[model samples]
Target: MMISAATPFTLLGQNLLLLPQKAIFWEQQKALIIADVHFGKVGHFRKAGIAVPRDMEQSDLATLSDLISEYRPEKLLFLGDLFHSDMNNDWDWFILWRSQFPSLQIILIRGNHDIIADSHYQKLNIELYDELLIGPFLMLHHPLPDIQLQHASGYVFCGHIHPGVSLSGRGRQSITLPCFAFSSKQAVLPSFGKFTGKVAIRSRLTDKIFAVLKDKVIAID
Candidate 1:
């Protein structure tokens, strides 16, 4: 499957490709940065007697595969929430997927929903970290506090709230779309999972917001 053309944006002098798949490819680092995948979410709900389409899980994996094929990144950096819940049948699916890419370096910054045992991730060769500082960006699951941002060493790339933007039309119609929210000191990525909620964000006058549409990423004017 082919993804829509990725939109390029510069932050802290680093060139990043914002894909319609709700992920970022850092050009210099050759890393695919994504967040809030919630891999086992569908299964978690289904197990609880909530009827969710089982194909939804496979679709997410397919999109990831497409991104990997398209970019061939050296590493995949998951800001947080790689899995929705603890070990479940959905985990088996993830295991099968991981086996297909044994050479890919996957890293996850532990998120609130990431309650799975460390040993499980270790067995899959996935690196775990609370926060990672690489080059000019600090990779984290949750955005830093206002006071911490004041003294932060580099621009932070985080994804906890599943940030989005509300767009208005001429007839006072408005819709919220997942977005890449960029301020001077931080950037929030959209959730990379199909079954996730997005919180519409209030942007500043100087902030740059790129809304992800069905097949493209568009800059919000």
Candidate 2:
């Protein structure tokens, strides 16, 4: 499988590629940054007798494999919510996926929904952190509050809330799309999981907002 072309932009002096797959690739660091994957979400729903398709987990894994093959990133960073719930059968799929890229460094910044045991992640060789500072960005799961942003030393890359933007069309019709919300202090990535919901965000006039369409990412102007 081939990945669609990613939109390239410069943020905080770093080159970033916003892929149509709802992920960001940091060219300088060779890192692929994604958020809110909620890996076990389907299983979580099915466990409750919701009757989701069994292949949903496999699809997500295949997408990840395609992205890894396309970008060849040395590191894969999950901003947060790497897993949807507690241990489930879906975790086995993730473990198998990880095995394919044993040399790829995987990092997870703890998020609100990440409740799995540390031992489980450790066994898979995934490094866990509450928050991480690398280069010019501070990677985190939740966005920093206004007060905290004022005192921060570097730009922040975060997820959670599954940020999106509303685009008004002709007449009264309008559509909402997942987006990359970039303010001066921080940037919120779109949710990488197909099953997640998106929350339209409020952005300043000067903020850069890129909406993810079916096969591409476009600026909101």
Candidate 3:
């Protein structure tokens, strides 16, 4: 019900808002879809002397909180890679953040980096699933190829590669921007974590790509 600068896009007759936060707001389902937050990444690297910023991890949580405040979504869904490592100091921060939105349902589609024991999330009332089908969308952590997608239970929404799009300017300059890449049967979301990296993807002619800018989302397909 709140206004947003996010770009509205429709898929399979369902309305979606492509957010500059590198996430999606599914209209019909009233769910906020995010991918690859990598909650403990900073702390994980710090343990190994990687020298990443200590406050960077909390900022992502703050962004999620802002989105929840604006959208008032009924559920928050993470496509995958919710945690960058097993357990770290940042986990405590996450626990504190979880306390604020105790009533909000959190669902995580287990990604490769999600190796933490289920009990940890269970105590917080966070539901974990290998894959999920809600409405016309199938939530998955890893993107599937066309061959496999043909057999998907529903139109797949995945986020593991942290998809980006390379744009070449008129002067031979090129920049890679995080993007939402949607095919006929699947859509790959960009990583929601600021500390994560993006992998530029090659899209087919018919694919739809929306690049995420600092304050808005732009359609490039």
Steric collisions counted per model: 0, 0, 0
Q: What CA RMSD would candidate 3 show?
A: 1.6
- TM-scores for all predictions: 0.98, 0.98, 0.97
For candidate 1, the 10 contiguous residues with the lowest summed lDDT are 3-12
Model 2 lDDT tens row, 55-138: 977887899899999999999999999999798999989988999999999999999999999999999899999999999999
The TM-score obtained by model 1 is: 0.98
Indicate the residue-level lDDT of 204 in model 2. Answer: 93
Alpha-carbon error at 185 in model 2, in Å?
0.6
TM-score pick, better of 2 and 3: 2
List the candidate 1 regions with Cα displacement exceeding 4 Å: none
Worst 10 residues of 2 by lDDT: 3-12
Cα miss at 157, model 3 (Å)?
0.3
Model 3 weakest lDDT span, ten residues long: 1-10
Per-model root-mean-square deviation over C-alphas: 0.9, 0.9, 1.6
At residue 74, candidate 3 shows an lDDT of: 94
